[model samples]
Target: EPEVTQTPSHQVTQMGQEVILRCVPISNHLYFYWYRQILGQKVEFLVSFYNNEISEKSEIFDDQFSVERPDGSNFTLKIRSTKLEDSAMYFCASSVGTPKQYFGPGTRLTVT
Candidate 1:
């Protein structure tokens, strides 16, 4: 089965810098999501996108965060400014209008 893939499995950045986390979701999936797990915490939803537009977003997805489907196969999350508190493992998920979601290995972001 095809699975989601993310780039730079581990990323280390300085505080106040910009970072873009990339993902290629399953080809047939119609919905894509960005989630984050802050080390010991549970996975938290940040944003969801469909048809090249945002469908929903959590409060955590502030003005600093943005999502885009730059091309047919690529979906991305951009953090305009990284903060120490934003350090976490960011996951990309996709589903075909179902509760079950396929998640990528995740990009571990470390902000100093």
Candidate 2:
């Protein structure tokens, strides 16, 4: 089976800077999601997209964050400003209309 893939496996940025994380989900999957796990915390949902629009988003996905499907095969997450608290491992996932989701190796974001 195909899998989700993320770029820049590790990212480091200064506080208040902007960053964009990229992901390429399974080609045939129609549902896409972004999740994050702080250093040792549980995986938390950030947002879900389907049919070219945001289907659901969590409070953690505040105004500073955005998701986009810039083309047929790529999905992205943009953080307008980085905060120390935002440092975490961000993961991209996809599913075929089910509860099971395939996850990508996360991109670790470190804010200083």
Tens digits of per-residue lDDT for model 1 on 11-90? 99999999999999999999999999999999999999988899999999999999999989999999999999999999
Candidate 1: C-alpha lDDT: 0.97
* Off by more than 4 A, model 2: none
RMSD of each: 0.6, 0.6
Candidate 2: global Cα-lDDT? 0.97
Q: Could you tally the backbone clashes for each prediction?
A: 0, 0
**lDDT tens digits, residue span 20-93, model 2:** 99999999999999999999899999999999999999999999999999999999999999999999999999
How large an RMSD does model 1 have? 0.6
Error at 50, model 1, angstroms:
0.6
TM-score of 2: 0.98
Q: Which segments of candidate 1 are over 4 A away from where they belong?
A: none
